[model samples]
Target: MDTEFELFDDDKSDVNAPPSYHAVSMSSISADSVQCEPSFVFSKAQTKQIRTTVLSLIRGMVITPDFILSSVGPTLDACATSLPAAEFTDILQESNIEGHTPLYWAIVNKRPEVLSAFHKFITAYKNDSFHDVRLACMVTNDHTLFTKLSLTSARLHKMERTLNLSLGCADEIQVYEGDTENQFTAKMQITMFQTRIRVVQKLRMEFIAQGRIWGLLFHVGDDTRWEASIYLSKHSLPARPKALLTVEAQNEQHQVLKKEFKLKEGCFLAASEYTNFSIRTCTSTSASLGSWPIFNDTIYMDSNGTLHAKLDVALQ
Candidate 1:
């Protein structure tokens, strides 16, 4: 935000005033007699080039405020998942040039993606071992964001907090029931301590049709795992709770890069249960738990698009 202007001394009058010019005939002033100091000035083209160079340099810096504000998704994703726990805490605690924490900056700019990524990122930090809870709590702009951050406080970092600190999506997966695509989602929660850590993730199945259900499990566990499962109700068939489902991994464009598989994967629920099928095992080798990318939004298709699911599989 620096301005390219010169400050005048006391000897000069009205430094802020616009320049005044007196109308004079061209012949009145002789070019040879009038002498003036030559100032270094760039031409229009040169000025534009200079501006472009400066902007490019600014963009190259890792912690520039402009870059952070514009691309919070990628920025926060990198910080949250890749950085060491201490370094991540340092960034959250540090303030930008405008005297605002990164979290506050994201809040002021309404970067929900950044906030969400941060929430996912801090899930890896050891519970009760937090050292920067104060910095996160100081943000008062967004009450919702503040509430989420408050849940990270050391004093409140307990089993209840563990349940509250879940990292998953609401209604992330959906299945069409008789032409209506009903929703399903899995929530992954992490609990950490000074000496021991425990993690629990669950996928809830609420709606079903013809005793068939399809869903994706993102980051089922470490190594960037993803799973696609199909389940059938025990009552749908005469005896066995098992069913057959074909699963395949599709790219963003829905192009199948991985082949399909037919497997015996299905669970049964009685009338007491809300949905009939709630199987957790993936039916394909491609979708099984392995080393997948963190930002992988790859879609896992069942029966070639009859049912689909995807999730942000970020590493803490």
Candidate 2:
């Protein structure tokens, strides 16, 4: 036998190894490879501290992103309770960085909870003066959420109801000169409704005539009437100088509705040396009537029964 020993790599095994050493190695490897969880988890004491800080900030009226983020829940509650009705109005008037108010932000964010709080505030404030309330109601469409909120809050329901009634009861009226036909025919029309009614009641018209003219007044039922006045100038001018024709309507109580004027045919020489000839309809209260000058011209009536020129003037 040879004195030198031959070493075999495959035979190198520790048959008596203990299992505890292997278990320790595996546990150490797992501990090293595992990732630590995120840090958003709040402890009980930390949560209390956050809530307290938020309440204090809200009470102090500190509205900042850092403040809000730190105490969003409590601050939101405080705004709903203390800042809604009165403070919210001030916030609305004060524009934010985006040229918008808290209400605008609530609308943009679609924050129903915040919107509901503001809606309640608006309804209560509007009760003292409905004008601002009506304006606010019309100001934006974000009120859909507010309306839903109103259904739940008794206070808002009343405010919205009154606004609806006010909008419904308003009425207005408008009037204008229809058209003229070759210094022969003139017509006027009136439109009435809530927003324009008061303005319409102050209307008046003054007609300046250059010659003898015919006038007619027609009253279309519903207490509305149309008036036409005509006149001629005394000069045999080559071209007709423009004439001013005016028409006005009065309200139900005989108050002027609206005054409108139109420039019609050019001034003509008066039929006589008297220098001035004019005529106005006496049937200011009549509903249906018609008038035409001695000159030949086509006449058409508008929806309001005001006469308008349908063809060019024909000098006979």
Looking at model 2, residue 263 earns an lDDT score of: 29
Q: What lDDT tens digits, residue by residue, belong to model 1 across residues 230-264?
A: 33222122112222223334455555333232433
* TM-scores for the candidates: 0.23, 0.23
Q: Local distance difference test, per candidate? A: 0.32, 0.30
Q: Write the per-residue lDDT of candidate 2 for residues 16-131, one digit (tens) a residue.
A: 32122222222222322211122145565643433333233322222222223333344444433332234435543333313334444444443435445545445344332222
Candidate 1 ranges beyond 4 A from true positions: 1-70, 75-89, 93-100, 124-141, 148-316
In terms of lDDT, the poorest run of 10 residues in model 1 is 189-198
Q: What is the lDDT of residue 127 in candidate 1?
A: 33
> What are the per-model C-alpha RMSD values against the true structure?
21.9, 30.1
